[model samples]
Target chain A: MKRSNRLVVLTDFFLENPRKHIQLPYFVTICETTKSSISEDLDIINEVFQNQGMGYLQRSTGAGGGVKYIPAFSRENSMQFIEELRKKLEDPARILPGGYLYMSDLLGDPRTVREIGRVFASAFSKVKIDVIVTVATKGIPLAYAVASFLNVPVVIARRDPKVTEGSSVSINYVSGSSRKIQTMVLPKRSLEEGANVCIIDDFMKAGGTITGMINLLAEFDARVQAIGVLAEADDEEEERVINNYTSLVKITNVDIRHNKIEIQSGNYVENHTDS
Target chain B: MKRSNRLVVLTDFFLENPRKHIQLPYFVTICETTKSSISEDLDIINEVFQNQGMGYLQRSTGAGGGVKYIPAFSRENSMQFIEELRKKLEDPARILPGGYLYMSDLLGDPRTVREIGRVFASAFSKVKIDVIVTVATKGIPLAYAVASFLNVPVVIARRDPKVTEGSSVSINYVSGSSRKIQTMVLPKRSLEEGANVCIIDDFMKAGGTITGMINLLAEFDARVQAIGVLAEADDEEEERVINNYTSLVKITNVDIRHNKIEIQSGNYVENHTDS
Candidate 1:
């Protein structure tokens, strides 16, 4: 193939497999090009990826060391996406009967979901995420989005058990906001033992649902390496059920009858951004 | 940006917005390039995409005509994915109590889901799909995957009513296999009225669930442009509740006691491949 053809193929591959390391020889074999030529092509690709702020390439000289594509967003860029999302989330029309915020519209949008996925992926870029864990049914899409960008699988815990999944492990936990006990179950084969898991959800009220996922991960001996949510409702106690978690939007207030809602950027803006 | 940079940017944009038409001048402004230069670049990109079978570019000359990226998989490639997936799915270990296939693992897999999404997108490339719809829990990921490729939002139907979503429209449909009436609900604001919707699901037993979705779309004055499923349970009648649809795999047999299962590629193989 010609150099342009190789560049196009390589670009497609790298973008699809973000955060994956592609060995040098593998590229030479696939592109039917010499090692030196492949190396030169990568340099050009890397420059474009970096200049575009899409991702970055890491190089190391040693065994088990090759080109790794790390998708990233500058702190400024990350904040921009979160702020724009926060603005949309603060609309009073999204207020539900309870303290909940209706986020189905936002969650259902592919463009919005893709941006959120990229933002979360950038935030958790440093962590090792083998699989993404979420609870059914609303969190499934958000978790899937994050997992896709991270190039990992998603394991969803269901509140209602179905016989179609064979045997399962169940766990009961307290709801963060409702203060009600809820049962969530995961299929036996849903996750691998000792896997590094990342928990993602569409909304967090009391932090209880995410905590349930954390406890559920323990059944498989998997570790919760990171926790992220699209929105998190604030409480008077000022401490969530699960600590060390990041949320993109912080819901400060929701007045149902008055049709009022208030929101601000979450910890992600302060933590994930450069300036 | 230079021509090389323009090429890279254009490739990424087209890949992300599959099935969406982009006018020539839009690229001219975005890439800071002449119309002739942008057209030349698209030709090169089109060649690589066609050769790799990832997608193809369509060109029209008259007014209201523009370039469109159609994601597709050649018949040989579509069969390869389905056959390989069928082999794994046919394992007795994946058998559930009532002849159901345990597909959560496959559904959660990003790579596998991407291929399934590509096949479905390719199959429905010519249709007018304004939105993708699916019933919640298991089908959310599959729906999200397809929506991403099609560059459309996903509207998921809920089995249980949640107060957070405000007003909703509910529908009752008998499941094709269970022969039991089940209720599925969608928020009123989930979809635009009269939109062209493509319904997708994880698995279809009696074709009842998809039928429910098609009925539900009627409440929104929406048109069912297409229907797709990851797997279809073969029935004795050789016809499902919904006559118009596509499935990636056909489950021929499942015997739990004997630990035997059988599968084959679905109708998509004959319909989607570019022979």
Candidate 2:
């Protein structure tokens, strides 16, 4: 195949199997090119990826070392998307009967969900997350999006008991906002023992659901490596149940009567230690 | 820039915006390529896409008739993956209480979900689906996956009523397997009037949920263009509520007492009218 054709083929392959290491020899065989030529093609791929902020390739040297394509949106790209999302969230028409904001439109948008996934994946890029965990219903799509980027499996916590899941571990916790006792369940085989799990959700108010998830993770011997939310509802008086979490947007204030909403950049917008 | 490098950028962009038409001038500004050269690059993309069964370019002639990339996986590829999935479904361990299958793990896996999306996208590629719709919870990820490939937004019908979604139209539907009444709601503004929609779900028994969706869609003046399910249960006595649907796998038999599950390729496995 010509170089142009080979480039397209290679890029497609890498994209299909993101975060997987492809050895140099494997590439030479598939592209029908020498090691030197394959390496040059990779250089162009890496350069274009970096220049366009599409993603990056992690390179290793010597024996057994190979490159892996890690899908990531650049800081600028993430910020730009988040800002637009923030503006969308600020609309008065989004305010509900209470302080809640109607974000179903944003959640349903493929571009918004994918970009949100990219932002979270970029934020947690340095972390080792074996699985992405979230509750059923609203958070499932968001979890899947992030899992696709991180190249990991997602384990969802279910609110309703499912006979298909077989025996499951169920727990009851107080809803921080409503103070109602709610139950969440997970199948025994859904998650691996000692896996590093990332907890994600669509919205966080008083952080009760994630708190329940943290407690639930204890049963699997899994540790919470990271926590990310699309939006966090800020409550000045009541303290959040957990910390060390990142949110894309923070709802600073919401007035139902006046149909007013206050929004700002989230903690995830700040630079964090890279591994 | 070289033609080889430009292919990388252009292909990446097209993939990101799948099924969306891009005018020729848009490529000229983005890739900094002359009109003639851009046309040549598209020809290469179209050839590779067709030859490899990757996808096809829908071309329009002259002004306002730029080509659009419609993502698809060849029939062979789709069959290979679906057969594997059928085998996975046949595992005795997947047999749950009351003949339910343990498939949360499969739903969570990114590669599995993406391939499932590809199969559905290929099956429904001919249809004009303005939006993808599904009930909340298990179906959200699958819906999002199909929507991603179709390059359309997903509109989830919430099982739980939330105050956030302003005014909503709610409908009660019977669960196919359980025969229990369930309520689902969708925001009034979420979908456009008279839009064409694709209904998707993870599993179906008598197809009550999607049938309810089909009914609810009428309230919004929308129409169900297509229906796809990952798996459908074969009940000997009962007839399915909805017809003319595609399924990747069929659960032919599920005996909880004997811990046996028989799986077969679904209606979608056959070659249909390829528009």
Tens digits of lDDT, candidate 2, A112-186: 898898889888888899999999878888888898889999999998878878899999988777889999999
**lDDT for each residue of candidate 1 in B124-176, tens digit (9 for 90 to 100):** 87789999999988877888878887889899899888888878999999877
- Candidate 1 chain B, poorest ten consecutive residues by summed lDDT: B266-275
The best candidate in terms of DockQ: 2
Q: Considering every candidate listed, which one attains the maximal TM-score?
A: 2
Candidate 2's error at B142, in angstroms? 0.7
Residue by residue across B1-275, what tens digits does model 2's lDDT show?
Answer: 67878888877877778898888998898888798999999888888777667787888987688989988888877888999999998999887666678898898898899889888998999899999999877888888889999988999898887776778999999887778999989889799999999999999888889888988899899988899999998766679888889999998988888889899999986755333
Separate DockQ for every predicted complex: 0.71, 0.79
- Summed over model 2, clashes come to 0
TM-score for chain A, prediction 1: 0.92
Q: Which pairs of residues collide in model 2?
A: none
How high is the TM-score of chain A in each model?
0.92, 0.96
Candidate 2: regions farther than 4 A off: A273-275, B256-258, B271-275
lDDT of 1 by residue, A88-120 (tens): 988877877666788888888887887888888
